[model samples]
Target chain A: AQSVSQHNHHVILSEAASLELGCNYSYGGTVNLFWYVQYPGQHLQLLLKYFSGDPLVKGIKGFEAEFIKSKFSFNLRKPSVQWSDTAEYFCAVTSGGSNDYKLSFGAGTTVTVRA
Target chain B: NAGVTQTPKFRVLKTGQSMTLLCAQDMNHEYMYWYRQDPGMGLRLIHYSVGEGTTAKGEVPDGYNVSRLKKQNFLLGLESAAPSQTSVYFCASSYSSSGGLAKNIQYFGAGTRLSVL
Candidate 1:
């Protein structure tokens, strides 16, 4: 079974600080990776996705993620985060196979950006 | 576009009560999904439909029933509600993949907060 793990449960950062959220998935074969963010009182929205491309994928906002196949990790990073970046982040994966198109998601990490 | 919308944004149910949660998508996408978000539990897939008449069980489907009788709507029913079923439910839609890894993003609804006591 495929599972996703996110190391951090709650993260606190001040405005202008750098941010990095770790995500790791247990899947040996090719997989699709995704990061979704949900602001307070909002729905989850796609942040970035990696199917087949350069290891680095950039999404909306200043966020980016690196898909490291060997380490089974796809960590999200932003050089500088603002108060508006406070949200719950989720990492998900889907095994690229016939029986597992459904995504498995991590427990999620809550990030609070202080101004 | 209305995107994905789940009705009854908030509801409270007594144990053993039955209710249906409706999910509707206007994107004309070919795939619809139901998920429940619990504290420390991420989103667990409940059910999904590939097309108007086709439905499949997802990771957690034992206590729920689903119907996708129309292309734009997917309904999730709780035959007998329980406090354990209290959670925020999300609906999502995506393009057709025929069981392949989908690169297309899943558009989500605002979510329905259901509390079963």
Candidate 2:
């Protein structure tokens, strides 16, 4: 079975601080990666995805993630953080095989950006 | 367009009771899914539907039943609720793999918080 791992359980950062959340998966085959964010009292929204293209993918709200195939990691990053960026972030992955449509999500990382 | 909506934002059920969760989408998506979110556990898929009249089990489908009688509606039922079933349930919809766009991009609903005591 495939599983996703998020190393950061909770992170507290000041405004304008750089952000980096680590994510890794346990699958060796072809895979599709995604990052989703859930703001306070808001639905889960897609931040970015990686199928087969540039390793670095930019998403909404000045967020970006890099997919490092060799490391089996897809880490989410932001050059600078804002108070509004406080939310719970999830890293998910799916096999590129026939059942690639199903997603396997990791334990989310809660980010708190203090102003 | 209300992408995806789940009814009864919050519910309280006693053990051994029964209830059904309603999920509706106006996006005309061919695929619908049910998931449960627990503290520190992210989300676990309970069931999914490829199309109307077709349902399939997912990662955790032991105590849940699903029905997709209409293309725009998907229902998840708990025949006999248990305390262990208390969790936040979410419904999502997305385009199928056969569609031009990738099937991994899913639109989720505002989840339903259920408590069984």
Interface RMSD of 1: 2.8
lDDT of 1 by residue, A1-115 (tens): 4799999999999999999999999999998899999999999999999988699999999999999999999999999999999999999998865445578899999999999
Candidate 1: stretches off by over 4 Å? A97-100, B97-104
> What's candidate 2's DockQ score?
0.65
Q: For each candidate, what's the DockQ?
A: 0.62, 0.65
Best by DockQ: 2
What is the lDDT for A5 in model 1?
Answer: 100
Q: Compute the lDDT of residue B110 as modeled in candidate 1.
A: 98
Which CAPRI category fits model 1? medium
| lDDT tens readout by residue for model 1, B1-68 | 88999999999999999999999999888889999999888999999988899999998998899999
For TM-score, the strongest prediction is: 2
Pairs that collide in candidate 2 are none
